[model samples]
Target chain A: MRDEAVLRHSNIWRPETIEDIQTKAELGRYRIRGFSALRSRVLPSFDDLTFIPCTLTRVPLEGYREKCSTKTVLGTRFAKKPLELDIPIMVTGMSYGALSYNAKVALARAATQAGTSTTTGDGGMLMAERENSRVLIYEVLPSRYGMNVHHLRMANAIELTVGQGAKPGTGGLLLESKVSDEIAAMRDLPAGVDQRSPCRHPDWLGPDDMILKIEELREATDWQVPIFVKMGASRVYDDVTLAAKAGADVVVVDGMEGGTGASPDLLMDHTGIPTLAAVCEARAALEDMGLYGEVQLIIAGGIRSGPDAAKALALGADAVYVGTAALIALNCNKPIYVEDYHKLGTEPYACHHCHTGRCPVGITTQDPELVKRLDIDEGAERVVNFFHAMTLEIQMLARACGKADVHDLEPEDLRALTLEASMITGLPLVGTNVVFAGGPGWKKSTHR
Target chain B: MVRQVECTGKTTREINQEIRRLIGDGEQEIVVLRPQARHNLGVAVLQPVKLVFEGSVGYYCAGMADGPSVEIRGSAGWGVAEGMMSGTVIIEQNAGNSAAASIRGGTVVVRGSASARAGIAMKGGTLIIQGNCGYMTGFMMQKGTIIVCGDAGEALGDSMYEGRIFVGGSIAEFGNDAVIQELTPEDREFLTSTLTQYGITSARPFQKVVAGRRLWRFDKKEFATWREAL
Candidate 1:
């Protein structure tokens, strides 16, 4: 018998998995990329739980005619004029430097048409965006790039961004190629310069220092607009509690799956928690502090469909923010221009080269030619359509669950599909009363 | 007639509220008395009124002035005349840190000394400091002209983009990404006119500090040279 030796493929620490080692060897610097977190870790998510519709005990509402309100009131805890949105979904912050001017205008117009709000991201407020948007939330980022008192007053609300879902502890990285003359003018940076926004605000030190800044903002705006504290999902319970104590009317928690203009892949995929776990922890923290209803919670990161929105609502989110999904809705990776994608060294959906300033979809690039490809009117229409579809889906789900209002969704309407989800959400598994962690039969003595 | 008001027993909020009400009533000339070094005096003044403060004021005095012309008769604390949009703010005495920070299309004149980071991040405005300026003056400044008639401290114009800083006296040191450029004929003429307008006629040979432009674009080889400057 001839003995044949077989060489098995190694899965543990695979050396030839895409040959990232070769790329690192060829280039001294690690590859910088963009887009959402692409890690394959199986974490607890909204998909882990399924909603239970109306049956014998519960009564179902009419889907076709009956009115199910999706109205959302935010920043009611402190601000004199809290925001009233016709829909619960709002556009997440995407800076002008990271996106084209036309993209920003499109988002503003679409949000206005959808009867929701849009956010002014890292850079200062663009004139077109401010004029088009009915309710604009101006972001006061750590960089303070375009912070002006007049612009601050122009906003309906102000968001103090400490971190993002993609890179929590790191600052933003804008490549020199993207920092055009126009963008540099807006950001107050040298044209064609690589910019690294500071990770922390230059004026504030810690939570204690945050109190004074919040007061300063309140005084600056005459206590008219709501103060939102946005944090990337890390130490969710503690961060949410601290934000509440710091006098935040709204707290936005972004998970690891959040997208960015440019970031190190290590930071995006490895850091922060999942959106499902973050919302649960945030709600738990608010509930524990007895300020759940007072301070609204908004969740983001990987929110795609209406089912995802409904599940997030049931898990304790007051509203939802869409960034990557919104971009996709605007034809970010629609495979329309194959030649342009080829020139970018990428394809439609697989493109993550936003930092290169060569986006084929015209959503993220600052190049005038590329920007012109995305028509403002068409983009706005797409956004309005996407928002309407999402709203309809959410309303449909709510009516099915016999909920008259979208805010009426609670965890009781949901059941965990897997034991891991049950443990994470503290919900009963399907067709079982036992949670195994802290359910009806949980006992310390028995577990010990 | 000057519409005079007293802030002796009122808080900053009340004083500002009264100011707002007076401005809303179309009062062009207003006088505020007994300021007593209080913070946020004349903040967010949007009207084209003339506001005169009688006594010393605290931090952020005359903040975010749009069309108002404010004259502070006494000294000010930190962040004086910050973010003034379209007005003239005259500080009679010394000002603290971040004086005239991020001013956009306005004029701020400080008669006395200014602390660190004066005119920091100023976009479009003219800041004239008659007295000496502290370290990091005009740090990361974008588009503005800052004239220091007296001596300047360390790191002047550090990481500045396009703004120009004219120092009439000796500079203690230069900041990163900053270089002493030759005083041009246009710069000298602009400086002379700006100073003459501000009633400063001293013939101190001025040195202009502008961006080196080395840090504008990132090159791996050039980062080593400009890293210390930033």
Candidate 2:
């Protein structure tokens, strides 16, 4: 036999791939997991672009001293009352079933304290969540589980969800381990059974029908709150345009990197467009229809820090929604419970066992024992600190770019670090004046 | 008191606002004229009142309403009383697709034939169709009662969780996990009372359809059943 160090691994048929095949062979089904994708290949992300602060051309405000407005207003088109947030960052929708009761309340409390908005997810509004939140966005998902008219009336905004990023064109999945008695009762499902939600809304189908559906929702709320049409970032240009045309006050595009509580590993690894590319397409779509500013755009998926949020805003987004990051702030994968994490067959930072309902730090599990580990007030404080830090980082970048308001940070303030980023965003690469490929404006020019 | 509103030049917004204002101002009965099949009329009317639509109405007429009794003299478009919590909707003529979709509780009576997917995803309510019904009737129905007086098209009661479907005409084909059950005296009594309340009569003996519960939980041994259900 040759020396062990001299042995070369096959690039095509890798060790991990072999293990995956064997696992599936034994299970006789696709593997299920939680969290975002674990793709090994590098995708174009916000990190590919860097902000160009004022050097000699533009005047820079003092980063620490100057006041930069983080105020974000969404849904100026047709809503009587739009969402007014203190910061451009918001807590994305995560269902009560996907997260524990303690986790939901903590997020709501933190959002209220931070003066931002929090959204309800697939399982409908938790009464405690509503009570804890100052500004609540009600989601009208395909499942329609626990949907109530009284709850609809009580919401500040309504989000008509078409799809999500992690698993587009499919319904939500909650594995048997996470489907507790309370969750089952709320969702009208049997306890301890894997819950697969419906992909299509029972009432409507296509965009034309969606127009009527929007009208119905508007009528339901007495046209008092904004109606947001949220979809996974596939066919972003067409989908965004249709959503805007169908009378959406706000359009949310969730990219492929978005997180989920439980999903097929295959779907998590492969589906939808990247958030960076998605924002460009969405902005272009809105601009093509001459409704860019009229209909607000919110971006979600893989937005980790202030730099990412700033880059997204510079690209075109009015606001950014964070899901996994918020959960992280609530101690989702903390290393405190070393033994518990080991028992789940994962390490502290490498844990993606949320689908198993055995979360060590207790943000995503329904088990009472795990849930008790997360103190609601302490978790809320931690998340509030994270939100503050993110908001400060965003403000610092905006001030450095000579923007008085975070929303004023435009694409001109950004420069691509790579050729792929330059091509995707239509931005000039650093130290280069050439635009390598067609960008957001390419579609408009072709149509003309 | 009775109030009449005209839909000649006013927008759907203006019309709905006026209807709500009238309801707020202690009007027990409101009649809408020349609806022109406009969509989203009398939606979200939580007050207990009576609404009379003189002509045909477009999509989602009386949608998301909690408490109201609406009478459409002409035909109705899709989702006639969708998401209604508790109410009564009576359509005089034919209804378009997905009529009474996803209603939690209420009574929807379609006097004439109804199009496809009627009573789809109904949570809890009673849907009475006097004439024929199109395909996929009661599809994914959770908890409700659908009474069809005439022929039922293909794929009836598909993937339903828990519901009762009584068809008075020839069976087309059952959908996945949907099974026919021998009707009991209690089911017959409920159907008779519901149909009679809606002024509907049928000559043919009704066949009851319900969920087989096979799709409720996944079983590895029942691969064929799971394959179709999934």
Candidate 3:
């Protein structure tokens, strides 16, 4: 007790996390999303489910050596040069102030090793991460950080964010409880106070101005980078049509289940269209505009595995982006952090506290000490491993489908369960082509 | 990287001619806004350039630059780098609104504060504000990131689709289709790196602001969940 008496007098934890946090359902909180909702609510019923059972005419993709290749090209619609990757999985954009530098580094390094690309979120570009990742997708958002000419010149592609699926129209908040001294400095904001970011752009008032803006970027960067526009699924047809017309090389649509830095529980469970529905609308929009196949479509939000990806592709997505699943691969719920998760009033599986950078496991903090918990090399390797696993799974699915390449999995290969899906996606059902029209045995949604 | 340049000078025709010549001669990188840069009333346009402005710049400095990275040494007049796409523009000093109006891709960083409507209707790209900003920043932005280090005026990020707004200081107000949520692991991880990358190691504990999910429209069950909570 004599030796421990002195140590007991003071706590070593950062002072910011202990105090300064009041209420977080707050409209005045800092920017970003990814938090657990304090209050419980009636969860949305996504109970509509169906199964793709095996039959005499249907066979499953071989899992191991089916010669299934998972490879695809993106952004050739407008850019003279497009990006090529060795694997199917790519890192999605998360932000600075919402994540730690080490996290970014891991993503960059992981993407590099996996031979895929990593995206920069709303927060400015981090040099350490950039140097590691050979291909980087820079995000142009409503809230710009560390933005400049130098970085743009280095970018492979630029994604213009309109909304995300998690909490589509909602602006996110990062609480001061997670704010480390270092994070505060880069952002140039006061320490320990809730920050607010307006949800709108102040420059132009309409689509016409957007056209000019796109022109300016082309002029400035010599048109080296492909400019893709991203939007939350709202008026899917209208939004994608506008984006294509606005000169986007690619259109990314995030479904309702998309992750966030920290969104209201109410919003995440409530907002936006599902990935399947949105894909249909977006596909229709591009087809009508004669830009389909020419303009690539990337779907994100709740994609988990190779099968999910195949399903999305069958529904018409060129590629599917996975965020939460990637985090899981990065050790999001390793059970080792069970105690830490409890400290945040959540569980390991509920590790969505992006609002507060003060993740107990050291994945998202500016504090040098806390950040040390993250072994960058090990983390990067984990990400690479995850990518490899996913690629293998995609290959398995493709081979089972009797295809040599994952890209060969097209919409025509899918069989919808409900008539609504057949009508929306134009795919035939498992054993019958009469999904929406006529078939021997079929079921239609009563709502339709 | 392909580069382009446009000179904003009295002779609009001359500036255009020079830019075209530079491109023709295989000069992929160009800088139009140099320190102490001066120009007459002329409309200039550029494709892309790793351009720099060492000194103060004049009006319409980067009126229609596309896919070029332009840095301005001094403050700019009205409509500086208006309608830029796929390139980056950094201003050492304050800027007029519409600095990155309708920006499709790339980013714009202002070391000093920005006037009103800095990123109006920005479709893509990012706008960084090291200093304070006037009202109506990020108004109707279809997508992109806009970060203000200093205090922001009213109605920021109004009706934004995607992208995010991170600020260190107090926000005067929150805009339409926008609310505040908590930050997650990825967000904190990003903040640590973002601060270190740009010598912004000074500000700790930044807040992340994102667009409200309601804009994408809602389903009946989803709508009920949101309503019941409130």
**What TM value does model 2 have?**
0.95
- Tens digit per residue, CA lDDT, model 3, B1-230: 54434443334335545655776676766555333444311123345546665567654566545666676778875557655656667788888766666665666778888888777656566777888888767765556677778887898777665567777777788888767768888867776675455555536456777777555433445333322222
DockQ ranking, best first: 2, 1, 3
First chain TM-score in every candidate?
0.95, 0.98, 0.82
For all candidates, state DockQ relative to the true structure: 0.21, 0.38, 0.09
Model 1, B1-230: lDDT tens digits are 79988998887778888888898898999999999988777887877899999988887888767878899999987777776788999999988888887777789999998988898878778999999999989887778899999999999998787789999898999998999899888998899898889898878899899989766655665333222111
Residue B228 lDDT in model 3?
Answer: 28
lDDT of 2: 0.89
Q: How would you encode candidate 3's per-residue C-alpha lDDT over A1-448 as one tens digit per residue?
A: 4676565433434342233232223223322336322223322211121234335676765556456666778888768668787865678787766667877898789889988899987666888878998999887665444445557667888877766777666554555554446554444333553444435433443565566555545544556688878878777878888888999888999877777666656677566877777777777777777787899888886777767777676556778777777766667656775776676556676566555554666676666776777788888898788778777766765666666777766655566765556555555655575656421111221221
lDDT, candidate 1, residue A439?
24
Docking class of 3: incorrect
Full ranking by TM-score? 2, 1, 3
State which candidate, 2 or 3, has the greater TM-score.
2
Off by over 4 Å in 2: A5-7, A441-448, B220-230
lDDT of each: 0.84, 0.89, 0.65
lDDT of 2 by residue, A137-202 (tens): 999998887788889989999999999999989899887778899997777656776778888887
